[model samples]
Target: MTNFRIWAVGCIASFFLLGVSLAFISMNDQTQTTSGTDDLYEEIISNKAKYEKPAENAVIDKVWKKTPGIEGRAVDVQASYNKMKKDGVFNEKMLVYKRVKPDISLEDLPSSPIYRGHPDKNMVALLINVSWGEEYIPDMVKIFSKYHVKATFFIDGAFASKHKELVQMIEDEGHTIGSHGYLHKDMAQMSENQAEINMEKANEVLYALTNKKVKWLAPPSGSFTMNTVIAADKLGMETILWTVDTIDWKQPTKQVLLQRVLGKVHNGATILMHPTQVTVDSLPELIEQLKKNYRIGSVPTLLSENR
Candidate 1:
């Protein structure tokens, strides 16, 4: 009975020792796994830190150095680059290093009379018809001078011949002189030959007075046929029409004239008026109001800027 009792005690001690050894082995394996996981996590963090910041900085520096021109446009280019980078599409094809020329030319344009200057420019032109009202021109000139604005005056050939001094005065004041057709007749009613004759007649007189070639023609009463355009084109002149007409010739009140102009005026507007009392009186206010929203200049000046 004593020997059996001793054998039971020995078996119990061996079982406890085996259990402790297994527990220690299990803990060591678990510790080794945790340490391996920690090393891999630290390596991942270190690699990200080494590469991420410099990659972002490289992208920004490359985009900024390639963009040109005004700072505003450069900012736009950078924003586009940043967006492209976010999409993983940033490449050399996105850069613009030079000014691109337009693919269109004058011949590519539609064959219609120019009713306004370039639509891209925030500008308006005043086209004054000088068919009759010679007496009021000086006052109009004074008002234009006061506002520091230049206009294009389409002069009747007969009126221009009779009033060369006024034509010279208009020219000296830095205003443009265009043909209003000879005899102030409707160009649409005339033959091509007659149209050419009339345009040449007006051109001769204006050239004699201003010593500058006439480059624009406004058909009398805004009446023109295709022949009129052809005739003007043959003479190296472009036909111009008004986008906004004041109709001061109908002798409207100053308020009516002002309303007609202000209501329709916009960027690239070619405003038509005549040398009349109402137009002369309304000129100052019209110019002052338009200057707030538009750059007032001659047709050529505004058109060239747009090109």
Candidate 2:
């Protein structure tokens, strides 16, 4: 009985010693980790300015009219530190690049024709005006899908009503739909009331189909007057023009289509195109090349103030 009691006591003492040692080791590791974290955060804060950038505000240009603002970036020290803490390691990949907004947004600018996005915004938009080429649209949508790109399609009102399935397909593929007028008439010749009626009629047809109010209008054949602009603005839509014209309606060669767009491409450039054979053939290569340097986006995304 005495021998058993001695052995039991020895085992209990050993267990207590082991527990204390483990607790000390744990405390020491925790202290070291905390110290490392503090050092890391301090380092990041010190070097924050090297990576920080200022935001560019939207401005009204004498020639371009309303221009979009490019979002800037800044290192968020506290947020980054917390992220590192949660991750339990120092990782450059985990650093948070928070967006710095501009003082003047797109909405702050006066209502006018938007010809291009902000020059500082490293992005491009493909503006597809759909009127006649019902056959080529499927292939164009296919190419866009294959490249994982989204484009803005300014659909004609009559076309939208007649080809609801095609419009739905384009919409389903995550493309933005806008207005292209009802009769494809010259807005330059129409009076304010005439233009307003035409636009309203188009909007009605589009709304019935998409169930969403149209926010953009591309006047047919690039014909518009201030009266047209005023009418569109009154109807709560912005008139959009393109920076680059593919001239696909003229049936340029595939190489010509590519060069016409890629050659003159710049930040905030809106490439206007129609549903033509040249576009369908050049879209694949054009998108692949454009993706190498620029972020291809929809019109709404290109014009947005957000990062």
How do all models score by TM-score? 0.67, 0.83
List model 2 lDDT by residue over 1-307, tens digit each. 9999999999999999999999999999999988878887887788778777789899888999888887889998888888888666666676788999899987776668899988877889999988789999999999999989999999988888889999889888988999999868899999989999999999998888777899999999889998998899889899999999999999989998899998999988999999998889889889999999999999998998766
Candidate 1: give the clashing pairs.
none
What are the per-residue Cα lDDT tens digits for candidate 1 across 263-300? 99876788999999989889999999899999898967
Worst 10 residues of 2 by lDDT: 86-95
Candidate 2 accuracy as TM-score? 0.83
The whole-model lDDT of each prediction reads: 0.76, 0.89
Q: In model 1, how large is the Cα lDDT of residue 44?
A: 35
Minimum summed lDDT over a 10-residue window in model 1 is located at: 52-61
lDDT of 1: 0.76
RMSD to true structure for each model, in Å: 20.0, 4.3
For candidate 2, what is the lDDT?
A: 0.89
